[model samples]
Target: MIDLQQDDGLWTVTLNNPGKANALTGSMLEELLRIAEAAQEARALILTGAGRVFSAGADIEEARAGLTTSDLWERLSGTIADLPCLTVAALNGTLAGGANGMVLACDLRIAVPAAKIFYPVMKLGFLPQPSDPKRMAALIGPARTKLILMAGQKITAVEAYEFGLVDRVVDPENLLPTARDLVADRLVADPIVASGIARLCQ
Candidate 1:
């Protein structure tokens, strides 16, 4: 489930459903996309999770039903990437599978100091979504990307910060505050000007 809250101009989009560890379902992803589109005028969007795992990636049952999981995931990732204002991901806990795509897509990632960032598709005999590897490579460097995608390394938040996978590693309680600061910092430039520069960076 997706739970949305707005404070000032920052939209906090939290992936709930603690029982599922916030596993993404088709309906949830659809809601996420819709909310993202509607929040384009907001100063920032902060994505987070309600429980110990940020997300377990696409829902297994949804995948088994042959729903367009990959495509839905891509749409979510693309929407996050294309957002005109700053986008931040607050990793309250571990990140795994396709969920990593959203982390890579965000402008900044704030992870709890002990959280693990993992991509285990290799062990499952599944390659990550086509766009994911390239995005990871661009952010954290090609060698690290290989270590992650090819070797299936489980990265800790500290290591991710060192590898440039995440911009900040903070205590769990500090995540939202840190995220807010990140958004505020980005506002140093006007949204129009910032969005223009963001386009060029992309």
Candidate 2:
């Protein structure tokens, strides 16, 4: 499930189902979409996960329960891409599959030193949902994006930073505070100008 909390102008959105590695169910995705869409008053948003992992991506069992993959992808990705405030993904552990789209849609990303990322849709006989490759390329460049999609290689946080996938890498324990601080700093500036700059960069 998704949890939302606000302090000052910062909104923290946490994925909170650690027992299943926070795998996203269809209903969870719907909740996430709703939160992102409704948090218009927030100056910035920081997304993180509970326990040791950020997210293991889509829940395979839930996918087996007749959820429409394409529809879920559209709603979730559209909500993230169009979020009114700046979005940051705080990667605390390994991330894979469709979850990549979540991080890709964020305006900035911060990964813990031990975090890893992989994209294995091809191995699972599915292509990434429409937004995956496109957003990935936009953040890290087409060559690295192709390497990740084509090889299904998992990259460490340092490697990801070097490849331009993440904006920074920090100690795991510092992830949330660091992300919060970044958001706090951003909140001091003019929201309109910040939004414009973010849009222009994207």
Candidate 3:
């Protein structure tokens, strides 16, 4: 599930359903894509999760049940990357599996000190979608992305920051505040320029 809250031109999208580590159901992905598509009214957007995880990725039960009807990667990747506002991932906790694509699409990221980041798509008998490898390489460089994908390695928050996957690392309690501050800083710029910068870079 997902929760959306808007305040003062900021949109915060939180992944709920902590019991399954916020593993995304098809409907959840659809909802997220919808929100991403409609975030033009916000000056900035934050992606986070409830409880202890940003997300554990796609719901395995749904995957196994053959309920994965949509191409979540394309929908999410295009929506987030094309949004006309700054987007940040408040990586409040560990992120894994297909959810890595969501993080990749964000314009910036702030991870909790205890968070872990990894992509286990190969282990799930799937390959990283086209955008996944491209975005990962753009963020962390090809050599590091290759190492991560090839080794199927899970990196700590510190490592992720060092590799450039996360722009900042903070205590879990400070994650939201830090993200808000980043959004505030971006809002200081003219909206047209900010959107242009986001478009040019993404």
Instruction: Give the best candidate by lDDT.
Output: 3
Residue-wise C-alpha lDDT for candidate 3, range 101-200, written one tens digit per residue: 8889888999988899888766667777778899999888998987778788899999999999999999888999999999897767798788677667
Considering TM-score, where higher is better, how would the candidates rank from best to worst?
Answer: 3, 2, 1
lDDT of 1 by residue, 72-186 (tens): 7777788888788799999999898888887788888889987898887778777677778888999888999989888889999999999999988999889999998888856
lDDT per model vs. reference = 0.85, 0.84, 0.86
Which prediction has the highest TM-score against the true structure?
3
Better of 1 and 3 by lDDT: 3
C-alpha lDDT of candidate 1 relative to the true structure: 0.85
Q: Which window of ten consecutive residues has the lowest lDDT sum in model 3?
A: 65-74
Kindly report which residue stretches of model 2 are placed more than 4 angstroms away from their true locations once superposed: 66-68
Q: How many residue pairs collide in each prediction?
A: 0, 0, 0
